[model samples]
Target: MMPCDSNMTSIVQRIARQALLTFRSPPRIGEEASKSFLENHSKLKSLMTEVRAADLHLVPRRASDSPPAVPVPPPVTYMHICETDQFSMGVFLLKSGASIPLHDHPGMHGMLKVMYGKVRISCFDRLQRSPQAAQPGALRRSVLRSTAEYTEDSDPCVLSPDRDNLHQIDAVDGPTAFMDILAPPYDPDDGRDCHYYRLLTDAEEGEHTEQREQKEKEVWLMEISQPPEFWCGGEPYPGPEVSL
Candidate 1:
């Protein structure tokens, strides 16, 4: 077993325990059980906090020498870790230059901890539509919303229902790895699914109201056609087997 196996086992143990607690009675996430259920799960939350890029033994390597641990622009890759009706955990490894496109998790909660190299996570908040919606033509790109970036050392991003749901992740400078956990694993029937998006750029420089000072530095993404450059290729899960 590798040194990483130790951390994997420890983290899995905590997740499994949380799974059991969640099973006894699905913890209501509102203000009611905020302390007992959510706060008490501080232990598991720390697992993500404790992990760092160096812990996974991730080192920069040329993509041509070996198969990408995750999806490349050519093929999508994913490794199975473990899954239960309540939640699922897995790891995604990206080769240098490869990226997981901007995507959304409709009705789930997730935590991502970097285990290998650095990653740039751009998060976005989705805007609500008014009851008296405007015509499609009137809904210009400017009306959509905000974006932010996160690193391994950054705080965990919270996505509720459909708010702040779309984002893209890119391995920075080199190959990278991150552990991911999604509760009530994506189910299309439940209206929880993943959808990809690309940044909406200002096509006509002076055509639209420009907010260069506020907008140039800020990433305003528009849902455009998916690019062929983004794709994931699968690799082996390097962690200990997780069982709950």
Candidate 2:
């Protein structure tokens, strides 16, 4: 299909519609309908392959461009596409060597599909009710779930409230960008606020460290305020408008 086919709504728009149908009425949407929506999500991934940077009005920087003399701003930026009570969708662009540090989605579910370039994502899962007192503050034990790399040709990375919900994303080699969707979006009043975390290691080094022999590596995490070095600057979404 032609990119931005004027005769039809874009695939992103179709995905938005399906997402709305899937999430708008959670209690009443039924199990079978929910399953169907997941199938739609898979189809959305397949359709994503047809998308190009130009389709989103993004112009990739050429390699020969001279580096700026002044200090450069943060290398990561975001484009707000659309949002509703059910879900929010957007794109994140990261320059070479940039990373979205280890953080969490609280109780949200998410899907991320790379649009261009590549990213390495490290994901973690919090152990249940495992908070303990530490010198600086409270720390919770967690398990390193997976570390995987993704490119435009890869499947979407999926996350749920209880699984692979905490992750760090880093751009590999050169620039990268990905489309992200979060369900029931982040609302502090609703207990879905985003939180940042740092992994902690025991200095004493005992049985806990030896447990690394197990399948999942366990570690402590300390909650903290957003890092001063990282911030997202928003840009207008330039693709076909989505309406739910």
Candidate 3:
């Protein structure tokens, strides 16, 4: 059923509540939450499904108002909402064809709910190896664990401390937006920082050919320098006023 305007207030309230509960004990990648939260607050997920990026007022605008003011692309823009020691909430809006590069949120948990349009999400896991299992200088291996498409109607995509922690999000065709919640957001001092990466050339498929191949099947990756063309423009948040 379509959520009504009247119910939106309640829904947002519930979301904030769940947000707090999640702070107490964040949800796992596959597991929604602790069994207790799952049992008692099952209605929370439904409410989340109803909320879209537009429903909230958060909006992105150019950091400056000057013309000849360098033209910034959507891929370069990122809008961060509230952040604290426990959790953080924000919304991201992307223009058609924009993308958030493949990056990793070290030791974090997150949920992304699409608000409009569609997004192609590619997720990966960094393979761990012992000293003897692999050579020192050899490029580290990364596995393409999964890939999924999300639209406004899709459920939130979940990520945990280690699994599927590395990912890239691309806006499909039209303008798209999504709500994001991160537990204990990126803190360089605390060691929860973000890092960008590129796929390592596959020995079997060859370099360029392997990168062009788009399949979920496990593939290797090597971190490379961040692309110079990529940059984000900043804007204001127009979403519901979050207090706390």
Model 2, CA-based lDDT: 0.75
Poorest 10 consecutive residues by lDDT, candidate 3 = 59-68
- lDDT (Cα, tens digit) per residue for candidate 2, span 78-181: 89989998889889988788889898887676788888889999999887654343233456678889999998778889886778989999999788888888
Ranking by TM-score: 2, 3, 1
TM-scores, all candidates, are 0.69, 0.80, 0.75
* Candidate 2: Cα lDDT at 174: 85
Assess candidate 3 and give its lDDT. 0.68
lDDT score for residue 240 of model 3:
67
Model 1 clashes, total count: 11
Looking at model 2, which ten-residue stretch has the lowest summed lDDT? Answer: 24-33
- Higher-ranked by TM-score: 1 or 3: 3
User: Per-residue alpha-carbon lDDT of model 1 for 1-244, expressed as tens digits?
Assistant: 5564644565555665664454334343332434555653465567667755434433434556566354434433566677877777777777776778877675556677776567777666554433442222222232233444455676555454444455577877777667777766888777665665655555633434364444533444444445667655566765545566
Task: List lDDT for all candidates, in order.
Answer: 0.58, 0.75, 0.68
Candidate 2: the clashing residue pairs are none
